[model samples]
Target: MSEFVRLDPHVIDEIVAICDTTLDELRSARRITDFLAIGHNFGDFESSKQLAAGYARKGAGTPESARERVEQFIEALTQLRDAFASGGEAFLDAQFDWTRQLQNIDIDA
Candidate 1:
């Protein structure tokens, strides 16, 4: 087998940090999508409380703060939806930003 390449501990730590940050951003985006989907599903219900309760029951976490969770969920979904809906131009813009961040990490690494 070929010998493994080794990196310094500090360098490894930095690289791991960069990866962690990127993954966090990705997960945030996915959570937003989930919340938005849930909101959409609740649209046809006639009662707000009942709908909220349903969401609370089905969601991964208990709605300790119902209003806040709903608001955060809706907000995240809106941001993701808006970003994608801005067409190819916006898509490129978002990619450019993420790429720039990645580039910086590479430079640092």
Candidate 2:
């Protein structure tokens, strides 16, 4: 026999929104990191090519490991939200800052 757990539909929606927002933050972080790494103001062809290559070389994170971590976090949050019937969604929202988190990161360090 197999065991199954059920989650609230609304919680599922919140989870999806959180995942989407998190992915967007990750992408913005990557763009900012790539720009900082390149450190060029000009839009010349060579500079553009170098910037693209730099991004490829300095990937945001290793694909498999990054994916696993993201999935784990989402799963954990899903469980917590399901367990906390009161103010769970609000708590999740409070923890995630779609834009402010990116601005707060200190890439220069």
At residue 84, what lDDT does model 1 achieve? 46
Model 1 has a clash total of 0
Measured with C-alpha atoms, the lDDT of residue 41 in candidate 1 is: 55
Q: Indicate the residue-level lDDT of 48 in model 2.
A: 85
Give residue 15's lDDT in candidate 1 (0 to 100).
52
- Count of backbone clashes, every candidate in sequence: 0, 0
Report the number of the highest-TM-score candidate: 2
Q: For this target, which candidate reaches the highest lDDT against the unseen true structure?
A: 2
Any residue pairs clashing in model 2, and if so which? Answer: none
TM per candidate: 0.34, 0.36
> lDDT tens string, model 1, 51-90?
7556655454543333434444444434433444443234
Please give, for residues 1-109, the per-residue lDDT of candidate 2 as tens digits: 1333445878766766775666566555545644434535546689787885555445434432333334444444444444344434444443344234434443432
Off by over 4 Å in 2: 39-109
